[model samples]
Target chain A: MIFRIAWRNIWRNKIRSLVILLSVAIGLFAGIAVLALYKGMMNSRVRTVIYSETGHIQLHHKTFKNDYEARFVISNPEKLLQELRKNESVKQVATRTITQGMLATTTGSAGVQINGIDPAMENKVSGLLQKIRVGSGFEPGKKNQVLIGKKLADKMKLKPSSKLVLTFTDADGNIISAAFRVAAIYQSENTPMDERNVYVQQTELNPILNLGNGIHEIALILKQDTATHTVAKQLQQKYPDLLVEPWQNLSPETELMIDTVDITSYIIIGIILFALAFGIVNTMLMAILERTQEIGVMMALGMNRIRLFLLVFLETIFLTLIGTPIGLGIAWIVTSYYHRNGLNLESMGKEMMSNFGFSTLVYPEFPTEKLLGIMGIVLFTALASCIYPALKALRLRPIEALRK
Target chain B: MSTVIDAHNISKIYNKENIPVYAINNVHLHINQGEFTALVGPSGSGKTTLLNLIGGLDKPDEGKIEINGIDITAMSPNKLIDFRLRNIGFVFQSFNLIPVLTARENVEFIMQLQGINKTEREARIQTLFRQIGLEDKMDSRPSQLSGGQQQRVAVARALASKPQFVLADEPTANLDTASASNLLDIMALLNKEENITFIFSTHDARVIERARRVITLVDGRITSDTAKVDTHVQH
Candidate 1:
């Protein structure tokens, strides 16, 4: 009966109450959707970094992790590949034999980093497979095929099936040159990674750096994120001479950028939550004041102050219960729509990615844990709004309330 | 047969403008069971304040008030509220029925507070409305009814609780002469037939004339206390 009375009393000023409710709902919904979008964008960017550029785990000779320029190529790629393929968690194991080299064409010569991998193995685990914009896929186990970044390819004026010679100092300090055809071209999201490294099938890196069957690093892809750390740990024990780093270590800037976004989104949402709380408090106080006489009559008729407190509290709870889901529903609809079409920041290309320290084309992901936090915030704001009004009602003298 | 209300040296002070005004001052009074009494005074003569104090709607400072064998002035705020719900009913001069509620709902309010079921509460409300000559108007809201009809609804609400006493503050003040007479007659019949006490604070001549005992006050002091032989009920 008290609830019935409170509910009816709330509608007496329909426009005012509705205005407050709508404001809270709008604020809450925007906060919820933005938070979700932030998380989604982070996951998509992180995914591009991990699967396309950085594998789940990378293994380097103990000295090369601290210094990438060190020529500590793993002496037994054949043996290590066999050992890694034995682990069931390993989805694909690819090799990278790299050196700082210069590419010389008839027109000009420029500096670059060279990475060699088996094309068949690279595609199974690397995101580069999905990023091939033109030309054929990486040719398998061949000595003359290479994949050049789109910007690098544009700068060099090389197309698929075009030939370019790579020149660099060998381990013995002798300059060597090798010829290779551009088997594919890739548009990299991040510019630093794009302009420097050109990918080749394992033996194609041979004559340019005077490298042989050995690779400087081994990249392992795992089926899921949980397996990444476990596989790294296992590989570390298996080869004590090599240092294994997870994808997070391979790409710290991406994680840091995502963390920054999460905190910034939180700061914005916190302000919105504060505004929403004030709106609820203002409206509820007005409601309690308007029904002062009715409350007095209810008290005189033997309803306790606790019951009166609940009457007001329940009105807020009911309004929030109805309003929050509507807000969440709106958030869900927007998130689902964006999740479908995807946010394309592709226009600025590598410069945007390098400046932001992320891949430009970001896909949003919605995980359960973060999305459900919105309910706690909405409920807490609603509950918090009722306190001052309920306490004031409990303090009022019955006669004064009736008289007023 | 015995005193049902005892107010001893009851006083109420209002702190307005930091200047204390004594609304009710050291007043002593006793009301017996089945008494039909009227307390008459002009505005701010402490009549409504005294009535509120007796009705457990307000407390008296520096005094003792015993109602129905309970020293109610000593009771806690919550206990006093319960006492009012169980033992006292009120009819205000403004006929402060919830404007949204029908006449029957206004009368049935106290019974609903008592947790009475719909069927029994409805029947009692119907009987009371018929007694007040508002059977057909039971479904009408207070605004839909005339001022006289609205006061009858207030009178019916006061009696719905079936309390030992009804505290009415100028209940007939808003009504015309005929409605005032009619309300007083219905109240008189209830006082006689049910042995319920009716205590009213009013300046209405019609109300004072119908009272079996009149207590008149001036400037917070009683000027007269007299009893009439009998009220002439206009048939």
Candidate 2:
């Protein structure tokens, strides 16, 4: 009977009740959509770093990290590469000969990390060939050729087929200079990282530096991220002398960004829930005040204070329960549509996004695991909103209530 | 007959600034079992205040109220609620039936609070509905019923618990003459047949004329207490 009365009481003022429902629904929808957008943005950043810059795992000579000197080369590169290629978990692998060098033009010189890469194997691991914005990436018979970032080429006032001098220390610690032609200029999402690094053919650069078929780094892209730690562990056990690092260890900044974005989304939802609570409290208080006389009559007829409190509390819960599902449904529909078609923020400008290594078009992703938590927050808000009003109902003396 | 309600020097005061305004002043009253009593007074005469004190709904300024030998004035608020639920029934001026509930539900509400079984509750409600001539409107909500029918539902609810006494405040104020006369006949019949005491505060001549004992108040003080000649009781 109490429940029946509570339920009926919710519809006493249909417009008032519906307004509360709509507010809760809209609040939840906005919170869910914002959370999805943030998740998509973070996912894009992590994928960009994994596929373009770090790969899932990297193996390097332990001493090569101190300073990418040509002398600290991996002694058995072919053996490790052959074993890794046979593993089912490994998708693609490439070897690089890294050295600190300076690229100089007629205008000026700038410090850079010159990566000597196998053109065929580097394409499989780094997707470097696809990011080439201009000029054919490396020719089959090409010698003394390099690919430079668009930013670096612009800074140097150089173009494709432009001759540039590369100076670095050889394996024997001798200062060697080689002139290489820029075969292509590539533009990647990370403008800063692209500007700091340049790539060249291993066949041509290794002979000039007296590298003798040795490599500094062995990078592998796994089919799935779940295999990264396992593959890294296997490689570590096989080559104890080498430093095998997974993507998380190779780039801790990206991992931290992912975690930080998750926390930030929760905080955003909390702010929305906090705001919605006040509206619910206001609506319930009005309802309580309006029904003062009726409540007074109930109390006079022997309904106790606890029952009166429950009547108000139950009414508020019913109102919220009605609104929350509608809100979640609206959120799901909007997110799903955007997730497929993508939300284009290109109008916000390319330079703004590129500076932060972000994509202009984001495919929003819904985190279904968070649905339970969202429902709990709404339930808690409903209960919290009812406290002041329900307490007021409890405080009503029968005599006074009857008069009102 | 045993005294059902004993109010000694009951007084209630309202505050205006720092001054005290007496609503009920040093009023003494005793209502015995099976008596049909009416408390008649004009506006601001404190008839409702005295009734509230007797019903244990409000505290008296300088007195005590005893119902069936228990000093309800000394009871805790929670205990008073329970005492009222089990011992006293109240009918408000506005027919105060739960607007959302049906007539049967309104009557069954008190029995449910007392934890009565459904069979017993239904049987008792059926008998009371028949007695109040509202058996046909048992399933009708307060809004669906007429003002007089709604009042009858409130009366049936008051008597549903088989309380020792009923306190009605202006129960017939909103009813027509015919409805008021029909309601008085039912109360008089119930008073004689079941020996249940009934006390009412009203300005209606119809209710006053029907009461076997009429107590008149002026300026918060009882001026006259008269017992009329009645031919209904054959003892």
Runs in model 1 lying further than 4 Å from the true structure: A59-64, A69-76, A79-90, A99-113, A129-185, A206-211, A224-246, A253-267, A345-354, A357-368, A391-395, B15-20, B75-79, B98-164, B176-186, B229-235
Clashing pairs in 2: none
Error of 2 at A361 (Å): 1.3
Could you give candidate 2's per-residue lDDT for residues A238-339 as a string of tens digits? 889999999999889878888887788777787897898888889888998998998888887788888888888899999988998898899989989999
TM-score of 1: 0.81
lDDT at A42, model 1:
79
Estimate TM-scores for all models: 0.81, 0.93
Predicted complexes: DockQ each: 0.38, 0.73
Error in Å for residue B228 of model 1: 4.0
lDDT of 2 by residue, B1-235 (tens): 7999998898888899989998988988888899999998899888898889999889998889899999999998888888898999998888989888899999999999888999999999989999999888999989899888888888889998889899999989999998888888888898899898999999999999899988888778888888785532211
Off by over 4 Å in 2: A230-239, B117-121, B229-235
Model 1 has how many clashing residue pairs? 3
Kindly provide the TM-score of model 2 when superposed on the true structure, using C-alpha atoms: 0.93
